[model samples]
Target: MFDQRKQDSLAAWHKLATQAQQWMDPEQQYDELLKAADEMEEKGLITSSEWRQLVRDAGSVFTGSQEHKTH
Candidate 1:
């Protein structure tokens, strides 16, 4: 079991929790997320292909859960 609600890694956990809550919010938009992805890509934190996948993931998140396609 988790020992505390706030931990040494609170920032990371908080980010994940916030995203999870937002994903379930009907009014939630990907504006900020897309912007962050763009910034990351521009800063070379993520490659072009990785950024494309991030965009794809955002689409899947907005359209409901994603189903992996069998090869």
Candidate 2:
């Protein structure tokens, strides 16, 4: 029961993570995500480490901004 619950939780996490990754686009999505993170940090809703991890995950999804061209 406990093990099953743990597995379920992990699966849910993965699904959410994947859905988040798919939203990286148009720059606005990243901007909105960062804004939310900033608000969360300001409100003490999330730790610095958590914010950093979110930024890293967002970076992985978007790679770079449109202003910057990758060679």
Best by lDDT: 2
Cα-based lDDT for every prediction: 0.51, 0.57
TM-score per candidate, in order?
Answer: 0.54, 0.52
Tell me the tens digit of each residue's lDDT in model 1 across 1-71: 23242232333322533465445452244454566567666756667887787667666654553232122
Model 2 error, position 71 (Å): 15
Taking every candidate in turn, the Cα RMSD to the unseen true structure, in Å, is 9.3, 6.5
Instruction: Encode model 2's per-residue lDDT on 1-64: one tens digit a residue.
Output: 6557545544543354455545555365566556666665676656799778766765654554
Candidate 1 ranges with C-alpha deviation above 4 Å: 1-28, 65-71
Which candidate has the top score in TM-score? 1
Q: Give the range where candidate 1 is weakest over 10 consecutive residues by summed lDDT.
A: 1-10
